[model samples]
Target: MAAVSLVSVSTVKPLGDRVFIKVNAAEEKTAGGLYLPDNAQEKPQVGEVVAVGDGKYKDDGNRVAMDVKVGDKVLYSKYAGTDIKLGTDEYILLSEKDILAVVS
Candidate 1:
């Protein structure tokens, strides 16, 4: 498997059922010729999974496997997750339940 490099810190491992997503920037222009202002841009719901946590533990100590993995491109709920920044890059930390679908 290939590796993804996040912050200069070298490694980022999400905790149980959480995922680290590298957010895709919101569009700058509409389908028409109009350009949008900074504050008017929508938050993008699409992102690439850079890291994923181990599956959550079950009541009997069994692990509930995750559906998403690192490198998967996914669509998430528009309002989910905590937004964070590393240097100039923006990212989101979300739970598996917040991910809507994986992009083919």
Candidate 2:
């Protein structure tokens, strides 16, 4: 009998103009050197782009080129994207339109 091997999903690839971002860690302390509780921490809006999907298709059957690529530091809308937790890392999957700007 032949054994079948199972593969684990270690990487994520966005599809259809979607982007995958690795969220940055939230602030742990305030400027006054006071540690804030988990509930007090705000959701991070900054993240690094890990993967991107092929650009959206136009009505003329032409594919638009994606503006952002891998490893681009970007800022997204506060409530944008779907939060995803893979293993010990946190990620967000959203459309390119949700991305506000690329940080230098």
TM-score of 2: 0.89
Tell me each candidate's TM-score.
Answer: 0.89, 0.89
> Which candidate leads the pack in lDDT?
1
Per-residue lDDT tens digits of candidate 1, residues 5-70?
A: 555423778999999899998899999979999999999999999989998999999999999988
Q: Model 1: how far is 83 from its true place, Å?
A: 0.3
Q: Which stretches of candidate 1 lie over 4 Å from their true place?
A: 1-9
lDDT tens digits by residue: candidate 2, 1-104: 11213311245668889998989999999999999999999999999998999989999999999999999999999998888776566788899999999999
lDDT accuracy of residue 26 in candidate 2? 96
RMSD of each: 5.2, 6.3
